[model samples]
Target: MLPDALRSRLALARRSLLPCRGCLGPVGEGAEAGLCGRCWGGLLPLPEGRCPRCALVHAEADCPEATAWDCGDALWDYHGGRPPLGALLLPGIKQGEAGWRKALLGRVLRGPLPDWAAEVDCVTAAPSAWPHRLLRGFDLSAEAARLVAGRLDRPFTPLLAKGWLRGRQASRTESQRRRLPKRAIGLRRGAAPRGLILLVDDVWTTGTTLLRCAQALRAGGADEVRVLTLFRAL
Candidate 1:
């Protein structure tokens, strides 16, 4: 039998060769996310009933962590839509599928910054551990933050750094995630955060990472912090 890792790679390889999920048109050779440019350009808006602050779908519009930041919003439901773009693409991006970055960025660029995002004087991102960055060959949150900065006409600042020994959030349970040490993430040396800040991340799963980075920014001297994530996990 094929190993699980090899099986997943074979599946992704096959999926890459299929026609675009949206239009059933032939995708480019070696396409990632199984979508053509036109189809990718046509991704729809996120479904409704999300917390305006946290971006997660909840019974109440305001999630318990809604108040953790000055304000925040996300682009799409992590597990929504027929293609489930978030579910389909993010894992690949996180695992170093650099080719998928362009497709994902195109989708995110379609969602303009909210009115509140205009007030952000500076843009920054939640830190991915240096090891993960090395393994993945890119950091989605950081790259997306750069795109957001360009869209906002703001400067992207490297605000926080993750401790070398910290664990990956994806591998942890909810309780362990909530108990993440304060030292796991913190202000970057020589960084002087100021005015209103926008904290960017790839996905908002538990809201723990964004909240922690916001706290770091505020504690480091930012007057206020707002967050914008690409997708919100259910």
Candidate 2:
């Protein structure tokens, strides 16, 4: 049998020969990177007109309701009723399509960041539920936070630790979701850091989870908390 290092190198070489996952076009010189320039450009110019505080689409110039986080941003608006192409790709990501997932996330990270992000002292993620992590085999939010931190040249910290809950928030009714205990998420014993923090998450549904995370960060002594999600469910 091939040595472990040789097998790993061969696997990477095979992946390098694959086409771009987004456009299914020839990866050419960028094969190792998983995306071609054209396909990467297609993901750009993310839909705008979202409330910077809640990341919700505001028909008016401002959000009517107040948001718990100091500010927020999202890559796409997920119309939950019909869903968008981005939403459709989310399931594939959670299913462990690493190439497509990395390409999509790379596009987002390479794009312009919010002005407030410049002031961010650290980056962290809203931890995934234990059951979900066990089933998905990866932490989507944590990966996103790491990518964002690397892109922004900020420190990445796992500030929040998730505790198992009775049911998945996605499977619960809006009212039931709202009733979820805030303590479902807690601050990591020594992970808290001072100053502005950018909390990353894969999606925003009712904002309850992010609120709980922000509360935990505050309780742990974060001066300011902001959220950055890949998509917003509207």
Candidate 3:
């Protein structure tokens, strides 16, 4: 028997007439695993034996982003499989769709924390431009970080600050995004998180932003950094 919370989500997914992704739906029988689109979309397990840090099915040569973290992981691989259902998850949160927050945190609880995650000392987030934060109901990264912190019983702090006038990174081309200025992100004044820090963000596109946040933490003297995003764009 499912818990009340899960029972309700499953019921709602059944009510949504949208076609399911693969095995998740097409009406009829009730059981766990594949109920409907939202249920499946809301919880995509990380790729088997792959890694989120590089969004790779297998890291061949050393990934360039490895330099910035002790360990990094995300809940879902944005491009891990066909049709790219993972890609839509981030926008649901950014657009302030109802229940997206709870749905995201639900992903975080899908499995036990990875062995590497046990060492995270503090939780912080990649800073978002203020206007985007306001438009999105709050800084998505910050809210995600707070949820992680609460679960881990660690302190959640705003240690990174984004440039005041910077425009949305999504509006820029891949080259433009990679060229994001180093100074575009920096440690907030007086913020000095020691030991391992977990950096949370909404999505990992080029990883330029997440790495930038990790870089800032290292510059401010954090011993190590780990990265977590709700979704990882492969």
Candidate 3 lDDT, tens digit per residue, 1-234?
899999999887756664443444464453222234434544465777664456556656565554487567777767544445555546665777556456556657554565666668888988988777777677767877887888888899899999978777988999999998989999888898798888888787788888888888998999888887777766
Candidate that would win on TM-score: 1
TM-score per candidate, chains pooled: 0.81, 0.75, 0.79
lDDT of 3 at 142: 84
User: Counting only residues 3 or more apart in sequence or on different chains, how many pairs clash (N, Cα, C under 3 Å) in candidate 3?
Assistant: 0
Ranking by TM-score: 1, 3, 2
Task: Score each candidate by Cα lDDT.
Answer: 0.79, 0.76, 0.72
C-alpha lDDT (0 to 100) for residue 27 of candidate 2:
68
| CA error at residue 221 for candidate 3, angstroms | 1.1
Candidate 1 deviant stretches above 4 angstroms: 1-33, 36-44, 57-63
Model 1, 80-133: lDDT tens digits are: 655666776788677666667787887567676678998889999999999888
Better of 1 and 3 by lDDT: 1
Candidate 2: 10-residue stretch with minimal lDDT = 77-86
Candidate 3: minimum summed lDDT over ten consecutive residues — where? 30-39
Q: How many backbone clashes does candidate 2 have?
A: 0
lDDT of 2 by residue, 138-176 (tens): 888898889889988999999998788566777799999
